[model samples]
Target: MTTTAEPPRSPDPGPVERETVPRPSQDEDPADTFEQRKGTRWLEPRLLLQTAKQVAISGVLGQYNDKRELMGGISPGGYLDLGGAGTRDDDGNLWLDYVSDLGDSFEATYSVAALLSRPTLDLAPQEGEATTTRRGRLLVMGGDECYPAASVDEYENRLIGPYRAALPGKEPDAPFLQAVPGNHDWYDGLTAFMRTFCQRRWIGGWRTRQARSYFATRLSDRWWLWGIDIQFDTYLDEAQLAYFTEIARELQPGDAILLCTAKPSWVAATDEDCEAYATLDFLERTVIRPRGAGVRLALTGDRHHYSRYEAADLAQRITAGGGGAYLSATHHLPTSIQVPPPTSRARSKSPSVRYTQGAVYPTPEDSRRLRWGILRLPFTTPAFAGLLGGIYAVLAVALGAALREPARGLPADLRAVDAALRDAGWARLAGGLADSILALLLGLVVVGGAIAFTQDMGRWRGRTVGLLHGLAHLALAVSVIRLAVTLTAEVLAVPAPWSLALVVLLVFVGGGILAAELVAWYLLLADRARLNVNELFAGQAIPDRRNFLRLRLEPDETLTVFPVGLPRVPRGWERRPDWRAGERERFQPADGQLHPFLIEPPIRIPRTPPATGAATSRTDEAHRMDEAQRMDEAHRMDEALPGGMA
Candidate 1:
């Protein structure tokens, strides 16, 4: 054989001396490159108003748009091949990483992204044993990839920008990325989510593979992973059902599956009749189980915390949504729950499975202690406080206008009534019927809104708590007006026109603090009753206790899940020198950065093969029945909407 001339080899570049490089000052760096200085103020009045409007518009539009149906026209039966070709390790194993609810504050997002971007992680051993795990060849973003809402600009700034900076350059063996849309993602009808995640483009070093929002992928011969998009917790459309039904035809006798959904329906199922859990229960009973495939694990991330529950048979239902969002409360999580729920309309003979809460991040005690931070709402959520202050100011003006005047501007006939009203003490404030009615209407509106905000409890209980809360604010408003009138008129002897300014000032300042305190106390009391707990923490916006999961699939059909927690994300970062030369990542954590630790020991799940003979025969018969039912349903859908399918 003739030997070809080899290309000349370049000289080695040697190890980089990172400490010698001059770093850019904060002022010198571009504005876009810096991490967000603060977390999203969820309690901000303007943001809350904008988000509410978007939710209403999107909810109505999603009913008609149905983007998943459109995806069917492009690729009817498409499923990605994640395990094919160059994805396996030397021992034929596969590694995967899961993260969700990312794209909140920049510091938290970049902190998690930088840690996941590393090629390998040497985790601290549990009991003196050292273990090192490699980065996954696949990255699954479970849900809520961006927060508040989904849009091109929002994705670029809060999500894509940080992830790209974490791993700027593409490698030869870059991992594949896939995502399931959360409720927030559907706020824009999934336009941004589809364009960002479904276009087969690159998010930093990760490559996109799915042609649709929902995806099914084979991790190995014995394992499969399915992610389904249930927009707004609704049922899956017929096209999606058909897509999975076709994939089910290729399933073997004993394949194991990992189901990923946007929300933790099991947790929701514990409280109420969750439609999402009902849909998943139907899909699992009809499509997967009848084919002799067992769903060993279910993963979700909408709750923004890590909580794992296990059944008697060791089946895991995990919620690992703590990518980079506000910390959600875990104290209220149930210790035991039944999937499909007693209220669900499940058709199967074995309707529900009992799952006991196993491990939770931050512990219940810590979650309870964190709620105290909500007491600082006046400081943390100043805009919300200002909104309250503005309302109090209006009520103060109305109350002040209703007070009996000094018998000068009053009509001659009303002097007697004004004198009687003045001597009535607190009752004197209700003298003018028109202004009192206005104040009464405003108070009623506040009370109604507070009642509406208390979602976790029944209507009567919420109304009682809300009535107490509203009355507290009204009492404070009255007290402030009475005090201001005394201080300006009796003490300083100020004029009527100037006294109005003092009344506004005291009410706006004192009312804001006292009103916020009342809300905090109300939330604290209501939390014990499991009411408005989500708002209590969402208002706090705690950026720490972030977490993600790293999983490894072995050749022998065993999967190990490592839950990693970063208790405190680093706020300071330095630019790497190699990044300027177009080689490596740009920013890295500075000195005193905290290290990630395992929230708990690695959870191992082994696949159980299906039985043979009589069991196998029964499974085949059940599979046929399910298939026939699905076919009939699909045919009806086709008849109703002839142009609906591809």
Candidate 2:
């Protein structure tokens, strides 16, 4: 029997320690390789094609509705029940539960639930060796709980079902769940989110405890958690503001407050002058700061990563949106925001809280690692453009020779280049060959100039890029058609109608080329301000890792937060029996999680060092009590920004 031979393998270059390699030039396409010209931009033509289709659909249907005015209809007295009517568990046995970017991707939800169920070991601040497992009393979901849209069906499969499956032990006494609506939730007019979280509908054993999407819970006499619903950037209605005004009246001086909203005001407010938004500023003025609540902390979940910032006022901001969704980049945080260091070991005084700066992930901070991210872009834009360029070049040569016009630099007798086109029997168009070629070249220049001009234009940047991108594709198609028509009549030497039919096919191909490029542009460049899917889907270089924040309230009423960072999820995690498939069933678990929960070491909160022997004084207790009283009177503060619940 003859055996099939395996392909020959190249000899390994083996360890060359201390080797120096030059980085690719700035202008060079990162996807370029000797084996491929124009790079791997067309590597995932499907994604390009899909994006094109979506763009077309969006243009025709206007997929989004702006409800800014409508959502601003909140009533000042519209406060929701924190724990349903009158069930009071005011023993400070509270769990300030937090998760964001949830309600989508079943596998991711499953993994996140498993991760949350995984017990965490917390070390006592006073004891070097003592540790305990701590859990939250309430389950607070940040925002974007459902994927694609906020329809009830989407939530049933993508959000509630997977969570129930993952945390099967949840019972009537399970931590209460409260959420703020996100953009996706508002897509269906907040119908599903309202039903799931605000209608007190039972999801597993957890029921929604809010009358409206936004809420205020009395964590304790000295602590409270407030969740606001800024429905897709709409204003916080007067009712919501009025409810918080009442909350301010009940506040004690020494009490600490936690603010939870739908999106990260600090990160999302890139165009704003300050780190937070005008809405957040308004809220701080009207509600939070006015109460004199000590140690104000703002929690947001729109950005799918973990980031923490501290302003000079000691107010803390955090993004813990990585509850269960596609990961976002930490490097994309605006340069203006001040990130706090991970540990405060050297400081003499310990603040009431500490936060991790930048992103704390398991990935290495190496040059090669970052270079891979930059290279991902070429595959999306340049690669698609290259494929179109390649096709046009081939067609140009064929039609150019049929008309006897040599490509500008080539010799006149360069018949061997496209000798096959000579037999197309299009002698009549031979005289016009040179003219067609020149026109094609002119179109290229015009298209290039238009792109350059738009790039430099300051106003309407996104619209300009989109228009120019479309124009460039159209110019390419026009040039190709001009060349193809010359030969179309002769090739289909039947009736005039037959030749017309063949020409129409060529036009269809041109449309496909246009569609492909349109999709590529959106996938690669449309939302450059935030981390996008190109790096993971097209480049396939980075791992599918996620980061989250875990907050556990201490017995002494101090909040200790641990930034839990998960490693790159294994690709094979989808094979588990619990996995589901199809669009009718949700596509085969790619772009999501389906494995057992696993994570690197949890980032622990820094502790205050023990002090030398000292006795407590009644003055200290009296001072703390006085501070609590002062909190009740400090009401006229910063204006409050209308924020949201999921």
Candidate 3:
């Protein structure tokens, strides 16, 4: 096998749990209250793992759909259209969609939603597959092309970094992609976007005419798409109007027309601008009316949410902007095709509220789809409680047991307590009081963490999340330093190895907690799959609920993501060398019942898992399958579904 180093991926966005055994970092929160510092009651690791595993199922892989069993057309007939969340910028910056997350936080309930989403994030490749098969061609909507200056530096960080992570393994196998600019993408006088994406405009002479107003693109020979790049409140310019007239003249009965612009005007930016009303008017008459003449849909992303709109009198509009920057909350659906002027201030800050927890977006018509978009720092509350509770409980038990037999692990001077307790009844009473104090502290930690879990708030980014994390560490450091100083005084006055150990342990514990918490900021804010094993690994990846032929592979294997449109794996690698075809597990579903099995098939699945960067699932496979005898006898590639089984 040819050996080539995989280009380095983005750095660890933060830290993650990496042990089968419980190994929690200790906390040192002052203002920490006694309870925040000392925790007890613990949830079994196996139970948490079980829950995590289950959520991982549907989360990593998306819900399966055979709807359309065909392609989306460009003509009124159809063409499949897809869009990426935002860009990584020219300089590889990972800018987030903060507005969306800010909006979602207010509505509350992230975990309740996560329960449904966890399973959708862990899907891997099938036995006969090589790349992410279901994904079709990708189209980019506006906003988040880059942040702030829209400089190449920002573009690279936001655009390149994220796209590289998201697209690396799949791009070579999936459909080709193209993008259009949003406000953020156009910041640097449009040069950043133009230079990074379309060095040569798909639209000839686009650069020369860019200042004149509207931009038009010829998708295929017959399909044409257009969008107006204008001020906060303005109509398509005379030039755009003139070009639009030409577009109308050029239109055929079934030509597909896609209209894109940054602001969807949730509530217009201003009362003085007549263009707000005029803009809507333009959409209705210029874009909507032409539907009869063959415009397919209006696609946009500035809204930050995913939505589909079909008015009885107007044309259809589909928005698939949720590609992970941050998420936004949704407002009530519009009452009529043409929105009436709002009489009061709009209450909702965002509009892309509801999300599918267990299912995929653009759901199959028959199966029913759910909408889900993950907001930033989703696990802060629950995780804090769970982590602190588990760790504190174990420590408390160990400490209590240690007191019963004080000399068991004691060093020289510290052992003085052991002899004193054994010698005098008074010392025993003092020991009892200390134990009580310890017990109470433990209880507080447990309860505090539990309370923290449901805190439910914040629309944070990497930088913002980092700031909070830095403070957490600072708080921890302060407490540890104080404890360390007190303990050090004892060390100088009367030396003992146990005293030194105590001081060191306190410092280490505090540091670990700080590090872990700091890393959480990145895992959550930066979207690092490992920093927080669960948040990044589980939350970021949608579960793979339905797929067939799950393949598990190890590193040092021959695999390559071909640079072709419909990506596939090499045939030679189909079967494992040691394991034969007969080794594959088998159990058919009896007459319409559910059947499930783990595929330890002969061939190894290409692609490394997240934790180890080793090909395939880091753990074993588990599946629940329904077969020939199952309900309706309808095949959904159902014959041998290993769909997201890994």
Clash counts per candidate, in order, are 0, 38, 105
Q: Estimate each model's TM-score.
A: 0.85, 0.59, 0.33
Q: Model 2, range 103-216, lDDT digits (tens) per residue?
A: 545445655655554434343322133334344446778898876556677787777765554443323344456788877677656667767875555544344556567777
Model 3, span 591-629: residue lDDT tens: 222111211212221211222422211113211222222
TM-score for candidate 3, residues paired by index: 0.33
Q: Candidate 3 at 436: error in angstroms?
A: 47
What are the RMSDs of all candidates, in order?
Answer: 8.4, 18.1, 23.6
The alpha-carbon lDDT assigned to residue 55 of candidate 3 equals 39
Worst 10 residues of 3 by lDDT: 98-107
lDDT of 1: 0.74
Q: For residues 398-498, write the lDDT of model 1, one tens digit per residue.
A: 66555545455545324433233223355455343235777788888777767766764366777788777766777766676566656766688765465
lDDT for residue 111 in candidate 3, whole number 0-100:
16
TM-score of 1: 0.85
